[model samples]
Target: MFIQIAIYGLLIALFPLAIVWASKDSNKYRKLIAVTLFLTFDLIIFGAFTRLTDSGLGCPDWPGCYGQANPFQAHNEIKAAEALMPTGPVTVMKAWIEMIHRYLATCVGVLITAQMIIAWWRRSSLRHSPWLATTLFVLVLIQGAFGKWTVTMKLQPIIVTIHLLLALTLLSLLVWAWMRESPPLVVSVQAWLRRLLPIVFLVLLAQIALGGWVSTNYAALACHDYPSCNGEVIPDLDFEHAYVLWRELGKTASGDYLPHSALVTIQWVHRSFAWIVFLSLGLTAFLCRKHEVLRANSNAIIAVLLMQFLSGVATVYFSWPLAIAVLHNAGAALLVLLLSMLNYRARAST
Candidate 1:
């Protein structure tokens, strides 16, 4: 079973592997980094789809489906569960979603393994520190462990949110790695602005965490309309239930039916944080426009931010459409990538 699963993983990774190998540029290492980053981005998007579709527990087990390698072999068990409860978590559609997510994740693992091997082999000639790549490899391994625990632990809110955060962190590191290899064009800006980049990055990271919390807690629909939640300036919010760190996915700490107010609290907090994120990004973009080298990236960042904001609003107004939800996630990741690249270029140019 394990061998079969391994083969499936390899198949998924083959295209990226080929691209990395066939590139004739002397900077093969940089190309490898780009490929890895792209794959990681896809993994994040698919992970979001898995969560939005309520397929997190499709397999109902860790690393494998019903102790079998793939859903094909475990079809009987999944069908049995679905037969008993037609709308239960384990069903044909959900099993595919869950298995596809795992397969993509495995392929990413393989790419990271290759990256580590190459970094070790070329450590002597490499311009950047190989230790960074090694560290990223280790982090991905830990992230994979948490991904398993997300399922085995029964989708505990804290664990799932952490899992999402780790994935974003991994994306940040890969973006850093890519920058180290082929530094972006240098920009001349105020010294204070340069320093602000890292601070903004930290703020964006926090906002991403809040967004993850809202998603994992299934609070997307907590607020039905814009500007106000449930037609109140400050709606009745159950902070006690909403902020409890350790609880099941949708339930409060006391095991009572979690009040709508709790969901409202989560949604409101996440929505409010969007303003902070938007203001920071806007400032960064304006500052970057002063430097010719960073002007293009700065524009791209603003465009993505606008798109992200629209998607966020649409997801809520449209009742959490799957396509928009996935795009919202992809937008967050792209923001991370663009910001990381800008910061790296600034530091290296200095």
Candidate 2:
């Protein structure tokens, strides 16, 4: 079973491998990195969609659906599962979504594996340390382990949140690796803004984790009102329950169904921290606007920041439409990507 899965993963990677081979550019490794990076981004977005649609358990198994490679092979078992729980997470559509996600993830892993081989093979000719490639390859393996836990553990909030964080972290590292391919930006900004970027980046990461916590706990719609939660300046909340990281997916540590107020608290904290990230990051971008090279990159973040905020509002106003919800997630990942670039440009050692 494992070998079949591994072969399926390699098969999925062939298309991208072929593209890199046919490219006229000599820097095929770098092109491969770029392609892998884009696919990683897509994987993160689809992960959001899968979670939002409650498709995480669509297959109810890891690496393969019903011990089969594709949905077609597992059709009868899926149909049986669906028959038992028609409105549950194992419908035919969701099985396909979950399996396809795993398949894409497999392709990503294979691409990174190939990168490790190439980096070591061509170590002398490379511009940057191949260690980053090796580290990313290791991280992908760790991420894959967590992917299995995400299933085996039945979507525990902490597990799911960490999975989301790891994916974003991977994306950030990839962006940093890609930046090494080009000349580092040397725009001189005041030391204060330079210092502020790292601070803002850390804060953004916390906010993302909180956002993930909210999503994992089904707290997105916990408070439907914006600027005010559930139309109250501060709705009643239960911090202890909400912040219990080790609890099961929808239950408390003692196996009770988690209270509604716990969900409220999760959403409240996430929404509150977002404003802090917005203001600090806004200032960081504003400081970069005067410098030419940094201006575009900074502006890209600001634009997405605004879009993310508005989409956040739309999420509440529109009651969490699928398209907007998925876009909100992609926006967060994009914010991380651009900010990583901004930081790399500022501190990269030439």
Candidate 3:
């Protein structure tokens, strides 16, 4: 069964591989990395869709649909689960969504594997070490483990949030690998901003984590208003309960139904932290954009930051439209990529 599933992933990966090979670009590895990064980006977005649609448990199994390779093979089992709970997380449509997401993920893994092999084989000719691709392969393995746990653990908030964060982390790693393959876009920066870049990256990551927490806990609509939440700047919140990282979905540590106050806390914290991220990323991008050498990097960062900010507000205003929410995730991934690129360039120049 596992071998068959691996074959499915390889077949899907071959579609992109074939296209890249046929392209006129002399650097096939670069093209492969580019495709890998693009697919990783799509995987992260589809992951959000899977979560938002409440399809995380659509298959109720790991790496396959109820021990089957595709949804067709598990159709009757899915139907049984759906019939038992009509509005539940497992349904035929959702099973397909979840399986498709998995299939895409497997394809990504296969591409990365190919990248590792090619990078090593061409080590003498290439400027960059193959270890970067090797590391990505390892991270994806860990990511696959988290993905499995996400289903087996029944979407525990912490597990699900970790799963989301890992997806973004995987995307960032792919960007890093892609950046290594290219001629470095060297650029200088102010000493203080140089000192602050890593901190800024850390902050963005934390904010993304908080956002993941909010989504996993289903706290997006905990507060309907924009500037105000629950009609107050400091809406009654229960950080004590909300910050309890390990808990079953919709239930407290003790297995009690999670309180609305807890959900409010999660939403409020994520909303509040946005301002800090907004200011820090804005300042960094603004400072970096002024330098001619870093202009493109800065432009990319600012564009995605604006997209993230607007999509965030749209999510609330439109009551979390699917497209906006998915874009919101894409924005986060892009921000991570651009920031990582900027940092890489700055460090290379120094």
Candidate 4:
């Protein structure tokens, strides 16, 4: 089963490898990084879709569906499981969704492995250190382990949230590496703005973690209103039970079913902290717009922030539609990618 899965992953990876080989761009290494980054972004989105659809346990196992390479081979077992519990996690459609996500993830792993091999082979000619490529390869391996734990651990909230955050972290690192392939920016910025860039990036990461917590806990619908939770300016919340990080999904540390108030607390905190990130990024964009070198990037930051904010609100008001929820997830990844580039440019600038 493991060998079949690996071969399947290699087959999926060949499509992108072929693209890199046939590209008109002279710098194939940079192109490969860019393509991997794009696919990684798509993988994150599909992952959100998987979670939002409640397909995380669709296959009820790791790497393969029902210990088989593909859903088609395990159709009978999946059908039996569905018949046993019609509303349970394992359905034919969901097993397919879960497996497809794994396949894409495997393809990403192969791409990164290829990247590491090439980086070492041409280390002397490359502008950036080959260590970054190697580091990315290592991180992807760790991410895969967490992916396994996410399933084997029964989708524990903490484990699943960490999975989401690690994906964003990988995206951020890939963005930084990709930016290294380009010429450094030649503009100078105010001292305060230069220092503020990293601070805001850290704040953004904290907000993304909070967002992940909200999703993993299935708390998105806890508050049905925008700018106010549950129709109150400050809703009654249960912070005590809200943050027991090691507890099972929908349960307290003592293994009791979690309260609605705890879910409300989770959603409230995520939405409130988002305001802080929104203002910080908005201020950063306002500061950056004055510099000609950073104007375009600054504009992108503002646009994504607005989209992210609106989608988040829509997710609540619209009752967490699949498209808006996935858009919210994609927006968070975009913020990580854009902010990574901004920080690299800040450090690279005079």
Candidate 5:
């Protein structure tokens, strides 16, 4: 079973390997960074899918499905569980979803390993710091550990939220890495704007954490409508239940079913924070427009922000369609990447 899984992992990694090898450009390292960044982006989206589909506990085990390497090898266990509770977490489809997510994650790890090897091999010739690559390698390892804990710990909201945040952090780092290798042409901006970028980045990171909390806590459907939740501007909210951190999902610290009001509060806060994030991105884009190289990147940021805003609204208005939800997640990641690239280019050019 381990051998089969290893082969599957290698097969999944082939595309990224081919991308790095077949590029005719002399800057193979840059190509490697780009490929890794792209794969990481896809990994984030699939991770979101895995969460949204409620497959986090599909296997109900860590690092492997039912102590076997893949879902196929664990068919008997999965079937037995399904027979015991037909509509429960351990269904055949979910097992596939969870395993596929694992496979993709393994492929990403392989790519990162390749990146670290290349960075070490060509450390002297590389213009950008190899330390970034080393950091990325360490991050991927940590992220993988968190992924395991997310399952082993039984989808504890805090653990799951941290897992999501780590993926975002990895995305940010890869974006930074890609930018460092083949930096965009930078035009000077006000010194104050330079100072503000880090603040904006930090704020965005916080907002992402909030979003992850909302998602992992299953608060997206907490409020069934927009502009008003359940026809009230500020519906009754049980902050105590909502804010309890160390409890199982869908239950309060006291083991009671979490009050509906608590879920509403979580969703409401996440929705409200979206406005702040949009405004921040808007201001950053406006500040960026002054630089020619940054203009296009600024436009991209604005477009993604707009899409994210629409998706957020639509997810509420259209009953939380899965496609829109996933796109919203992808939009968040793209926003992070664009901002990271802009910041890196600005720094390198200066």
Candidate 6:
């Protein structure tokens, strides 16, 4: 089963590999990085879709669906599960969704592996150290491990949240690697802004993690109203149970049904932190865009930040429509990408 799954991943990767090879661009390695980066972004987006659709446990197994290589092969078992619990986690459609997500992930792993191999094989000729790709390779492995735990652990909030964060982290590292190959189109910034870059990035990461926590806990609708959670300036909250971190889904650390107050706490914290992210990212991007050399990066950052802001608001006001929710996740991934590229430029300018 594992070998079959591996073959499927390699086959999925072949199409993109061919495109990179056939492109007129002389620098195939950089082209490969670009393609890998693109797929990783898509993987993150689809991952959001998978989670939002409650397909995380569609297969309820690791690396394969019901010990088979694809959903088609597992149809009988999946059908049985769906029949057993009509609205439960396992269904034919969901099995396909979950398996497709895994397949795309495998494809990405293959591409990253190819990157590490090429980076090391051509170490003398490459501009950056092979270590970057090596690190990516390692991170992807860890991400895969978490993916398994996401299923085995039954979508435990913390593990799943960490999985989402790791995906964004991998995306950020890929952007950094890709940006290293491109000419740095940035000028030296003031010391203050230089110092602020990492700080802002850290803030964004924290916000993303909080957002993941909200999503994993099904707290998006805990307070359906915007600007005010459930129409209160400060809603009743349960920080104690909300952040226990290692509890099962929808249950407290001691295994009681999680209270509404805990859910509100999760949503409220994520909602409140958005203000800080908006200011930090917005101010940094606003300042960086003033520099002609940094205009593109800064503009992309600002545009996505606004989109992220609006999508977040719309997700709340519209009651978390799937499209908007997925876009919100995509915006988070894009921010990670843009900020990572900016960070690389900031270091290069120094």
The TM-scores, one per candidate, come to 0.96, 0.97, 0.96, 0.98, 0.96, 0.98
Cand. 1 Cα-lDDT: 0.88
lDDT of 4 by residue, 177-204 (tens): 8889976779887778889999999999
Write the residue-wise lDDT of candidate 6 on 179-278 in tens digits.
8888656487788887889999999999999999999999999998889998898999899999999999999999999999999999999989999999
Window of ten residues with lowest summed lDDT in model 1: 181-190
Root-mean-square deviation per candidate? 1.4, 1.3, 1.4, 1.0, 1.6, 1.0
Candidate 3 local lDDT, 153-223, one digit each (tens): 98888998888888877877787777777876646677887778889999999999999999999999998
Quality of model 3 by C-alpha lDDT:
0.88
lDDT of 2 by residue, 1-350 (tens): 66787888899899999999999977888889889999999999999999999999998988888999778999999999999999998999999899888888999999999999999998999997799999999999999999999988999999999999999999999888878886566667667777878899999999999999999999999998898998898999898799989989889889999999999999999999999999999988888888787889999999999999999999999999999999999999999999998998777622
Weakest ten-residue segment in model 3 by summed lDDT? 180-189
Backbone clash count, each prediction separately: 0, 0, 0, 0, 0, 0
In model 3, the clashing pairs are none
- Pairs in clash, predicted candidate 1: none
Please tell me which predicted candidate would have the highest lDDT against the true structure.
6
**Residue 86 accuracy (lDDT) in model 6:** 96
Model 6, TM vs. native = 0.98
CA-RMSD of model 2: 1.3
lDDT (0 to 1) per candidate: 0.88, 0.91, 0.88, 0.92, 0.86, 0.93
A best-first ranking of the candidates according to their lDDT comes to 6, 4, 2, 3, 1, 5
Report clash pairs, candidate 6.
none
Which window of ten consecutive residues has the lowest lDDT sum in model 2?
A: 182-191
After superposing candidate 3 on the true structure, give the runs of residues whose Cα lies further than 4 Å from its correct spot.
none
Positional deviation of residue 260's Cα in model 6 after best superposition, in angstroms: 0.5
